[model samples]
Target: MPHVFEVGELTRAIKAVVESEFPFVWVRGQVVNLSRPGSGHLYFSLRDAEASLAVVWFRGAQGGRISAGGERYDPLTGEVYDRPLAESITDGMEIMVAGRLTVYAQRGVYQLVAEVVQEVGAGRLWLEFEALKKDLAAKGYFDAARKRPLPSHPVRVAVITAPAGAAVRDFIRLGRERGHGAAVRVYPTLVQGEAAPAGIVRAMLRAVADDWAEVLVLIRGGGSLEDLWAFNTLDVARAIFAAPVPVVTGVGHEVDMTIADMVADVRAATPSHAAQLLWPERGMLAQRVDDAELALRRIIGTLLASRERELAVLARGLAWLSPARRLDRLAESFDGVDKRLVRAGTGYLDGLSRRLADLEARVSRRFDARSLDAREDALTRRVERLTAAARMFVADRQQRLELAGAHLAGLDPAGPLTRGYSLTTVARTGKFLRRETDVRPGDKLEIMVYEGRVRAVVTDGGPDAGDKS
Candidate 1:
């Protein structure tokens, strides 16, 4: 089969086929042999355990953290720049690259021209993980003080997992075989995808609100970084941290470590390992039960033997005496003991009755005395009040008499008369002249003496009686 064409024409035909067959598709891989070109383009190989794919992103796009211009070189690689220089990205980071899948025509090498790039960083999932851990820590949720011991015998086990997956089947089978007698509730959801984080959050909320499960088991089968990316979301991490019941996370193969594993109360390497952790082997449990039975039987036998020995000792003490005489004496002794017991009991009862009666009588007497004293005090207070009221009434009468006397003295105008004073008046009018200056040359006044009345005329405006009136 050797039909030949010109070299350029052949190359052109091959290029056309490549472009037409594969337009553009999203490819996922790990970062390897990574480089940041001077122009700020990322050149790296995205590979898994299987094979590697070449990927590139422009500087304006995601040439690395903090915007690439004027950034110093990384000493490890000594390159002009680093792709995804953000703290979030590292060499071993698992990620998904989305861009046009293109192949170099001459070299036949394929590479993705990335339009957008994000680090499948654990901290993204670990962000929720750490946040929830902080919250729970502050609230003493994960404190040793609050931890409840696992139930020795769990009647029911609630599994929060994807249905029909390897995790669910393994748990149920292991649980049943181990004779755990556990009623397993499989709550299924997408383990990894855009929906996974939300699904995990809802399951956790419902479990806490409803009190539905005793313990929770979260499991996912092994997968590549891109396939398992959802488990790394913050929502999923927090959900595990916030779950009320103790959570056991069984995720990834032995190699893959996830944030869920770290935050959960327990981490199982595989879904099968998770089941084994919850329940042990039935044969081992049966052996333990048998051992317990044998120990209990030995203890019971020892107790019975001790009782028999006590009975035998008592019997030996009663051996071989004069039968009738002994019997009579024993009967009499038993009667004496009975009489003494009765007397003791009767005496105790009588003493108790007397004490009770004395207490009751003292209480009654105290109550009666207190009541009578209160009444006497009240009566004494009333009597004192009545005496004070009488005194006040007499004093009030005395005050009234004193006021009447003052009124009478004022009406008599005798206060001035008692002081050896006399009155004068103008002869023409009834104006009393206490001062000689009050009288004018033409005025006349009248005056009332202590005993009678007089009228006179003013003869002069004299200064005073002492001044030759």
Candidate 2:
């Protein structure tokens, strides 16, 4: 008889075997029901193109501090996606995951315990679309500021679309019909499928990354909204947003709408319309070029005329600055001032000096000649009168002297003697007297008491007479 094992024992044995066999492994798949409970445990169904398995990640599985949110990626299609996501977890735009693949023991299923998730979903993409639209609109990126003036002679272009799609034919037709080379570069990519988002995003990044393409013409012939959903992804939107060059999106038919059209720098209703935005018709461009040439000629002519006018004005200025004219003006001014100064200084000094000299001469004439002559004449007459007076006085003195002499002669003693007045002689005494005493014997006397004096003896003249001598 075969021994039967209990269900719990069987499950435990299976768990032991499964863990022992698959302890360290990695599995990639998509989640069907991704959920988180309040107990901090994660539960989900991880599947692939073949089959799906139930999964449970217990709270104990996380070492500590486990978070609930990650991005919810699109279901895997057995193709490896190598593109790196932009943002990490806790960014609100949750991603499904990428991490260690583990199996649950109690549930008896294989599952994916993801480390990360990325690439936003439909609802996430829609939210991003609304948010970006509002943001760019507020910033006026959708306004006139970000819009560049389209080139009229856009000859070479890089076309971004499915290679075999109808959009290529439309671009080719439009480029040729405009009589322009539109040199289209067809970069083959998936417009719709698992790889379509990355493909479109890559094409967009390249349209700007490559230096040849001036303005990008993102064309798709026409499509329904679902057919163009790859273009609506946030990945595509981000790629278009980051394009350095200007982007031109012509995604769906005129009636349909896609997020690519919204995020693009410029949007056209159709692929044919993108051509119009990029290049005008060749005929219009040629006409414009011709017009520009003519304008340049007219500007040259106007500049020449203005230069000629300025030259004439400069010549007139030069003529007005002649050296002879300037010298004459300065000379005239100097002459006027010099003459005035000379008249004021010399004329005043000369007139005053002349008047002063005349007054001085008149003053000199009033006293010098007449006064000097009259004083000389008066001094001479006075000197002559004084001399005459002195001479008269001398004459008077001489007359008086003569008269006095006559009187003296009249009184002379000799005359008296001659007139026989009285002559006495003393005998032997030589005495003369008016009355002579008698002379003594032996006395001799002779007397004459006048000019003719007689020698007389002194003996008789004293007492008795000198008669006794």
Candidate topping TM-score: 1
Mind giving the per-residue lDDT tens digits that candidate 2 earns over 1-469?
Answer: 8879886777677767765776554344565575677887666665677986555555554332211222222232111122323212222233344444444556655455544343335334445555756765675545555556555566667778889888778877778877456677777788887699998878767766678876777787554334566876768767766677677888755544566777677888778787777777878878988999999999999999999999999988877787555655655765675567556655655665577567556756676777747855774586567557645655665576557556645654445656677577665444544443444434556655545546544433444554443
Minimal lDDT window, size 10, model 1: 73-82
- Give the TM-score comparing model 2 with the true structure, all chains together: 0.37
Best-fitting candidate, measured by lDDT? 1
Clashes of each: 13, 29
lDDT by residue for model 1 over 25-111, one digit each (tens)?
Answer: 556678888886677567788889999988777766554223133443322112223334433445766776666766665676767
TM-score, one value per model = 0.42, 0.37
Candidate 1 local Cα displacement, residue 342, angstroms: 46
lDDT, candidates in the order shown: 0.66, 0.62
